[model samples]
Target chain A: MATAVNFKSEESQAELIQLVSFNLDREEYGVYVLKVREIIRMSNVTRVPNTPYYVEGVINLRGKVIPIISLRKKFSLSEKENDKQTRIIVMDVDGELMGFIVDSVSEVIRVSAGEIQPPPSVVNGGVDQEYLSGVINRADRLLVLLDLERVFSQSERESLINSSL
Target chain B: MAILCEDEELLEGFLAETSELLEKLDDDLVALEKAPEEIELLNGIFRSIHTVKGASSFLGFDLLVKITHKTEDVLNRLRKDELKVTPEIMDVVLEAVDHIKLLVNDIRNGEIVERELDEIINKLIPYISDAFRESAVLHMESAGTSEREKEVPASPVQTELETEAAAPAQERPRIEAAPAPSPQPPKPNSSKTVARGEELSDNTTVRIDVKRLDDLMNQVGEIVLERNRILQMNQDYLARENTANFGEEFSKLAKRIDFVTSELQMQVLKIRMIPVEKVFKKFPRIVRNLSRDLGKEVDLEINGEETELDRSVVDEIGDPLIHLIRNALDHGVEDPEERVAAGKPRTGKVVLSATHEGNNIIISIKDDGKGIDPEKLARKALDKGLVTEDQIAGMSGKEILDLIFLPGFSTKEKATDVSGRGVGMDVVKTNIRKLNGIIEIRSEVGKGSEFILKLPLTLAIIQSLLVDVENEVYSIPLAAVLETLKVDTSSFHVVGGQEVLKLRDSVLPLLRLQKLFGVQGSETSLNQSYVVIIGVAEKRMGLIVSRLLGQQEVAIKSLGKYLADAPGIAGSTILGDGRVALIVDPAGIIEMEESGVTGAWAA
Candidate 1:
């Protein structure tokens, strides 16, 4: 019988962290492994009323409504240039399965928990540190770990809810 | 090993469960207004609040957890008959639900928000006993009431005792029982005491984003265009082949391609089909607020909430429908005293219903109010110089009612915030025309008025009657084409220096596409000419074209920024041979024709 590898368990036991990594433009970013729900191919998303610019819109994921956010736009990147490899990463944040559009998802990396360091304050001239949970150096690549909850301000989040109402 | 990891997934399961519980809470609240005595309803609402409070506290959303905890206390009291479900109590609870919805929205937006729930919690405190308010730690510890509180006014204390009383009497052996002799008021309804009766069953439904469906539609359109191109090519090839085997193969290929393309189109169209419930849901709240504000007794009855419409149409229809409903209440429905004086019921009725008829959905807003007075409308039109005295004398009642749709025309003496600020029915007409829909109004003085709006089921794919003027092909939406006829050239005569067609005693203005599009005239006169009668905003006109082409389902592709504002053209579509065919905006053309503009020449 083929066994399903318990990566989360092994990582915790070995004091290693599993990161769900994806590519944005040319840079690599990783979120905690537990945040990710699954990876799905691009599907139809219905535009919702009164959403913010970065929110591409909401989609019906197997009968459950989930909003899709364009990470590129969220980070103030230029408008998307659609390519074959463009994908949406479905992640469960606070129980909501939100799909964030990205260039493509890379492999999950296992790094010792001790290897993760606090994010640099002035990486590339004052990067937005609110979104950065931590940073891990893996070989030649610097993986910027994201704290997804910090992406929105309190008032802005309230406005989003008001618009939905 | 896997069991430990699966604990992470438990949070997601809890979220799904909590959201479902919240939805039930909302539906039950709305239902409680109609059936307040259903104890099961109160218990169901209490359980949902309890579950949310439990999960929120566990998840460390302190503010949400706190508010839900307070709300649960109030609900517990209400369930035990300690507090009546008064209007004030309902308001506070609904406000709490609104706050919870806001919190959910915040979480959805990826914010760890600590909201100020003090105001809502304070409002709810009046419903709870003073003991529950004094000590937060005590409230958390004592989940059950003391046996001495049995005679207390139906408080959260009594509810806990009741639940304990249902359990084995030995379970409370340590409690003092001297207060059990206190007299209690008999409950009004025996059936309202049971807890499980009011819980509403979960009806799971999903909300979809419309953009995905639009993208799918665009892809299907391209496939249909490709299929048409291939079929056209096959036709040319098959015409030259005399062999039976070649003909059979070509036909088979064509059949398969046709089947696939049609199915693909239908599936894509299905995604755009959303029930009218989204639009209808807001109306109940609107009517409630409006009736309260106006101090009028009005009941809003909505039927056919399940009617499906294209998502695009549904979005656009909301504003217009709101305006129409407000108009019906303000102008059509008289005040209670006025209604009673007029021999009508003291409470006015506004019925908003939608029904699917053939390929169109007919939505009617009928109100039993003071119907529109055509005489007053005619007088206003004449006063505003919109119509001459002679025109009023010759006009019918329906024609006079339509005059209200004229820009800057309103019979109301003073402008109010709701309806009459002089931005009259013209906007409604313009918006309906933009959707390629029609609106008709019927009224009888002292009786009532009804506004009927007819809209196509889907705007993505439309069957268009293709016609040619000079050398260019233009598509007239089949919905607007009333009829086509072959008219003798002699039937046309110059009226006011413009050609007019006289058909059966009705003089309809004739618009030629060659002249409309700035295409040079051919200089050759044909005795027989094709005339397509098209309707725009309730007015019908004859469109004189050179030839009539067969109808086909054309996928509407928007003309990019440069040509979007061009008059007389709605959008462009791709033909079988990859040629772009401009679809005629009949309403725009009719407006241009009425405005006496011959053509729009590029600068």
Candidate 2:
């Protein structure tokens, strides 16, 4: 029977978790800090046949082929016309190493865990919420948390594996 | 380092929820294909998309949210009965799902994909009418939809009149008239209702990370090891502690521990269970695309998409299935004119089906078109020097079919866009072999061909028959072992300068484990000789071993980078005694035997 007052008092000093944020188009998104394996500049990617449209191709990382996906195309973002400020974030999901292309990475920011709120029913003029975890409000900007695991299920990941092979 | 403090709990929750939604989306989409008019299914699809859209939007994944929203709009119309579920419409929705899959992948990579949704949106445009768009605003406000019912009433009156007038003339006319007014409302309405019904059903589902499940399996394996130690300790204690009723107590404790450990092991294995529909869903589009590209009329049919398999096995089986489907479409199916000339149906039928056979899952891709011509395969094999004239003469039809899986072998005179790249079937064999599965092809000229793939329920744990070659132990997957026999050395005879063992009536080439693995052993007596009969790619041989141990369930551990490429060793496993025993790759060993390289063990 605890009311909103009880929660407010408990939430007075909110817990903040630092996240490395990046931008795609004009919006900023944050991924779990530990999920990221590395950040590197663009590299040559070999095209794999019969893959989904958003998969840019696969890159050879020390002889191991890792699929590279364009975050812009994946999220249905407007295709970037230029290569300026583009970066690839490499991450390991379910024991597979995959790379994601982003516009540019911003600074790591610490926002109170309590400050993060469940995604609203609608956002950015009615954008969908399949890829989002939650939204964290910073001083003047908002960081959208991403659910990486949901981003690729076992089947989708298998497609990447098949194309790579 | 401060960034490391970011709470993963919330993110994990999102992952779990979204993944569950995606899985539901996948299941409903597959079901939708079977029962296209099921309003409840349409509703289920609508909710899945809506939920995904809502979640992505909240997470600030504008790209994901936006695309899902567009797809949701199309589904919303479907659920409302404004849009009809035509194959074309299903194609668009499936493609949208593929796009969503790509978006999810992109999100996982921590990238924002911004692309024009116009292509997908354009695909949805023709389905929507001005009236539907006018009512879309009202539908949005109601959320639950008096607006849907409004469109339905108006359309139903006109549709009923059209149906009454057109029903006497032709079935196509009524279907065409019903869908023509506005395709938008039915799509969303169907999905929405279906989703609501599914939500109301008392089916409980839990989301799990596959990696975590794999870790749990590994931990259970360690516990089994610890249990073995405990059992041994208990036996020793029982002998030392000469108290009465010791036997009863020790036996009960051992049985209980065994039961608990086995249950725990089974529970962990179940966590990795995934339906075969995950692999089945992509085939419809593939079949459609291939049929169009090949200029052949094919009716691609699928059955038993609900079959469950381990995640790892499912991951490995997709490529082989694709190759089989491609091969069937390209080589098995004849052209329309040829079919008509043969007095058969002009439209070829390719049926992909899965069913459980005993403990194994059998997936068969059958085609009702031109079957494999054994003579043609034999001629090609001879032309390619894959087999000699004598070999071809002695070969059976099944043997000829097996020749197609040989690397760089293609019987097609002219390479087409669909196939004949000479890379697919061999890859199918290799991949299937990697999963410890077997592929068999059956065909007759002028009839159809069927490629059957027999796969284990899971790849993580395998029942292996432990055998001793000299002093070292090796595991042979029970799936590959046909029979074990104790051969008398006197029954061996030399044929073509190779030792062969006569079992029953057939002569099997004898490959001695000691000589094969370079183990120094003294000559053994005839009565003591053991032979393990194994089959690979339709080639059967007898593996002569020093001793035969009983079968046991073994958890596979990859040999990692240092030893992965090592010949003869498929992977390693820890026995109950905690000793690492290498699992033998029967296919690799068979390849070695076929290539006239019998000295693999000597190396």
For B72-161, candidate 1 gives per-residue lDDT tens digits of 778888887888887678778978877876665454333546666667877887788777665543443442344122222324553554
Model 2 agreement with the true structure over B88-125: per-residue lDDT tens digits: 87778777776776666555434445645557756755
Alpha-carbon runs more than 4 Å astray in model 2:
A1-165, B1-44, B74-94, B116-248, B503-507, B525-528, B599-603
Give the CA lDDT, 0 to 100, for residue A127 in model 2: 29
| Range of the 10 consecutive residues with the lowest summed lDDT in candidate 2 chain B | B184-193
Each prediction's TM-score versus the true structure:
0.61, 0.62
Clashes of each: 11, 66
Q: Provide per-model DockQ scores.
A: 0.02, 0.02
